[model samples]
Target: MFGVAGRISPGPIGFDVTMIAVDQPTVARHGLTIVADHTLGDAPDLDLVIVPGGITDAVERDDRVLAWLRDRARTPTIASVCTGAFVLAEAGLLTDQRVTTHWDDVDALRERFPALDVVDGPRWVRSGHVFTSAGISAGIDLALHLVGVLGGPDLAVETAHRMDYAWTPTIPEAPEGPQRGT
Candidate 1:
């Protein structure tokens, strides 16, 4: 969905997106072969950074990846989906920030980074220049929101309409009391 979000073009609100990785010829968790067209050393100055989550442990253990993220944390916007929040937290970019991730990993995120204000039940959360989303599909919603912010609400709506997508702009309130573990 990162590709989809990056390709969203509603009139003049189009984005020029590029994919980068710590290494080339990486395999996705689902067995998809991803050829890294750009490495961190070759990345252009970026206005936005979106980190998609999978196999968080491996990403956390890669010093090169962590250093690259730490360098890019100063970008205009940085976002993560699902377990990608772990990467941001590990990079010290999420300290004292309210964020959310896949519901199943909320507790783990909080435990791993006690300084982070990990929110629950929100499809997405934005604190300063950082954004995070719940799970897979939620990343699209967060991207649309970013589109609205970067382009305009009209363009975002147009993009969603063109894609036949249902966009939810508001975060719903979580039910009171203790939440069950996923």
Candidate 2:
């Protein structure tokens, strides 16, 4: 939900060349605002950083967000949903990392970030510091995965069952070797 960059749109007042902000609240509700300052992950700091994504071109190039993401990298948990993978990828955190995103965005994500082992249709992925989800709907699944990892199996199971949900990840075939995290 941390949208560091602003959304843009066509300008009013006959200014065809200049654009206007698209009222980020329209897109990022729940008390959205520009991040005035400060890098993330100083010590006595963040436990987990969640980057939820939106427009691609704008987010990929944001300097502030990228720096924070890189800072957050050394911290314990860094997770993303949907196109937020763009933020993590932009930070180069995905180098040699296997990750996932909304199913439709994976190809372009890979095209934009070749260093990442971006899979085709997985609901999510967890590799080292990065945890990503395909949550084009299944964000809850991804969140549950984090809950399982952080809180242990029983809490995760209870959480999922509370929603009357079954944990069904779209796992791509594990690579040629035994799985690394298992």
* Candidate number of the best TM-score: 1
Among all windows of 10 consecutive residues in model 2, the one with the lowest summed lDDT is: 1-10
Best by lDDT: 1
Reference-based TM-score of each model: 0.86, 0.66
Query: Least accurate stretch of 10 residues (summed lDDT) in model 1?
Result: 173-182
lDDT of 1 by residue, 82-122 (tens): 89999988888889889999999999999989888999999
Task: Write one digit per residue (lDDT tens) for candidate 2, span 130-177.
Answer: 778885555667765655554444545655666677776332322222
